[model samples]
Target: MKPDKSRSGCPDPSTNALQWGIKVKSSNFLVIESDASRAQAIVSALSFLGYRPVLADRVDADETGEQWRGAFVGTVEDEAQLEQFLASLGRNARNLPMLVAADSPVATSLIADDARSQLIELIDLPLRYERLAEAMRSLQTRVEPIAASRRFVGQSGPMQRVNALIRQVAPFDSSVLVLGESGSGKELVARTIHDCSPRRDKPFVAINCGAIPAELLESELFGHEKGAFTGAISTRKGRFEMAEGGTLFLDEIGDMSLPMQVKLLRVLQERVFERVGGNRAQRCDVRIIAATHRNLEEFIERGSFREDLFYRLSVFPLEMPSLRQRLEDLPALIGEFNQRLVQRGLSRVRFAPSAMNALRQHGWPGNVRELSNLVERMAILMPHGEVRGMDLPEKYRGALPIEEVTGAALIAMMEEQPMIADSFAYGEGDPSVLPLEGLDLKDHLAGIEIGLIRQALNSANGVVAHAAKLLRVQRTTLVEKLRKYGLSETVQAG
Candidate 1:
């Protein structure tokens, strides 16, 4: 490659190894390294491999009519440097996948509390060419967000609907009420809306109404004066004030007591509130996004929640689908969690086919949160390993076949054949029942079992508990047969 000339047509020696003040291209990587020697090595490798090494100080890519492919962040000296480097990239570069030449702790600090799932890969010290090439290749394929999601991940119908609603309501200032069971990602939905809205650059403060004490809940929402209460010590800004010009997420709003509900309702109605023990009213400019696992309509009927408050919060009520309701999304969810776990310096692990099937059999009463916990736990127990069916917790492995279970797993599983009659398809009086060319007894019975299980699952809307009831057998037994016959949720969903 020829030397890049300056505007005065002078050969630029400074731009030979490390590019500076040059327009970044899709074929270039933006280098923001604090370590001089390591930065030179990385830039040299890039230039050797025919990539233009672009520095961070160049004019914004937009002004130069250039598009960025990705960036290489150097070893961070401190959190402040990390923040400054990221901020210098400008908001337009938010989607750029970052390959960091830093330790695990540095990567964790960079990923902390970021809702917009920025794709980042970590490379250890004494970097190898293979690792750099691999990271760059990955970034190349994923210049865009993952499979239609920047925050939420899933391709199921229910998830698609949720994404649609988030997009539809995000542009407006209307309050969004996310309803779902606890741990079903209610807060994620709220955060996604905030990130996609015009107030994205502003603060997004969240507080759990159910977690805070009832007496202190008021003070928590509306700031208190110095002498408001015994522990008031000093005046403070509440969630509302802190989220000014942004979004304030009130999680578990239904858990708020009747009196607190009244106070909240007044704020929503008048768009004004005053600090506790203060006579002056404060104008509220924050957008409210509330969520709750409880049924507010039922709470209102029982006088536990105010009907007026319900209307204010439910301007756009979004129902988050439970994990069971979208079982087909288990793979995608697990993949997302693996990405997060890897970012936290944890080794990634993949579930064996049998183990994934066993996961599909679970009731998942705890929803996505439960799945995330299981993923992290499995990664910890079997770091950089594949999780087999037997490796799962007893509850998850309860339905494993006797051959797959360990001696201890027997405690959770009971093997009894008399629970259900293994009726054959042959007629009692037909001569074929005695067939001269005798059929394989085990194979015939297996076919009958498979048919019966399929029918039962079809009738139960893919619910194992209801299917077990229909077949008059144990849920564990049905689940075991499900694995044996390869009848997973996809088949049952059909």
Candidate 2:
């Protein structure tokens, strides 16, 4: 490990650096360029970004085997030397952010090969000041502590509004409808609402309407008396009863069957419900917080969702932002997730500057959940130290933010690794593969809709309303889809 020697103690962009003179601050930076001009560019960019730039021949130790958080490895030529330098950084390499400087051609290779270098930002020579500032802002946000204990971790303006809304409505008992795409943490918002509510002490019961069967849903919701039906040998209290004074989170509420919708509407209207077989109407006391990843309006237009039910559920609506829309929050999210991964026992993975840059650029259709899962997978698979650009999965590598190096080199590498191709083709024989290339766009979309509805229905067990809610569409739309797709034949409860 090399002891860090700061050439210039933390340079303030406003005073020492040029351009818009925006104030910036970064812990430290490493300038690893063999060329003096490139090294100067690296220093100038770091200074503009408000970092203490250090130019060193090699990283050395302070005393008791402790290397400084800041380091700069200038004029590097050999791979073995670079590897040895990174190895000296140890676990600190994963935490202490770095910035690398090399020729234009070498910069790409540096980012791809060195996983231990936690470069928060990259500087291409003849640097653009505005780009550097943006990168600096991103790094600062990721390291700061969040103000609230919300599942959402972001410093972006949209997320700030989200936090404010959670604080405003959390104390109230009004029913909340969380709207967001799949894997956007809608349920997490529901949990936050419950945690902030007056009923925080009570049990928070969560039921995935899409996961239950229509036949058993009624029993699951409204307690069934002994011998209520063929499987009702024993009486059991429903979810609402179990929830009691606490919150009853209905995930995929858009998937409920029409008949069940009527039953549920009646229960909500009167705050009372009878057992499946028994005629005793029990008093209900539970707060409802529902979440769905589908658009309810489309369902209502299709006649599958009741407009009245929508109004009843959405006393307040909380919409979660997609990851792409909140790009500013990527750094913070990456930092938080990295810390969480460490807590969960996987501490080897660390994001290089290029990797983080790639993460921000890619469209995370699956959203935060996908990022979280990918991070976990990376932690498990990356070569023993840090996760760099090349360490990323193949799908992500092609979609990397940077322009790829093509032809012979990459092709030969891919050919050498035939197992990568083999792994991707492992499940090729699955029957679920459906091609919609020739179908009309609307019809193709309809098939997907029908498939999701049917899957939700089967999983919910013939509960049309529950299935509708689970699919995040209206009950009417679900019904229409059932009829349109000939799913009505299989959906018995409807």
Please state every model's RMSD to the true fold in angstroms.
13.2, 27.8
Cα lDDT, model 1, residue 29? 66
**For residues 18-122, could you state the per-residue lDDT of candidate 1 as single tens digits?**
554444445356777756666667776676555666666554635333455567777655533444444444443445677876563356644542432356777
Candidate 1: 10-residue stretch with minimal lDDT: 411-420
Candidate 2's error at 292, in angstroms? Answer: 0.7
Candidate 2, which segments miss by more than 4 Å at Cα? 1-150, 398-494
* TM-score of each prediction: 0.57, 0.52
Error of 2 at 40 (Å): 74
Top TM-score model = 1
lDDT of 2 by residue, 284-387 (tens): 89999888987898988988888888888999999989888888887777777777666545664678776776676678999887887887798788726766
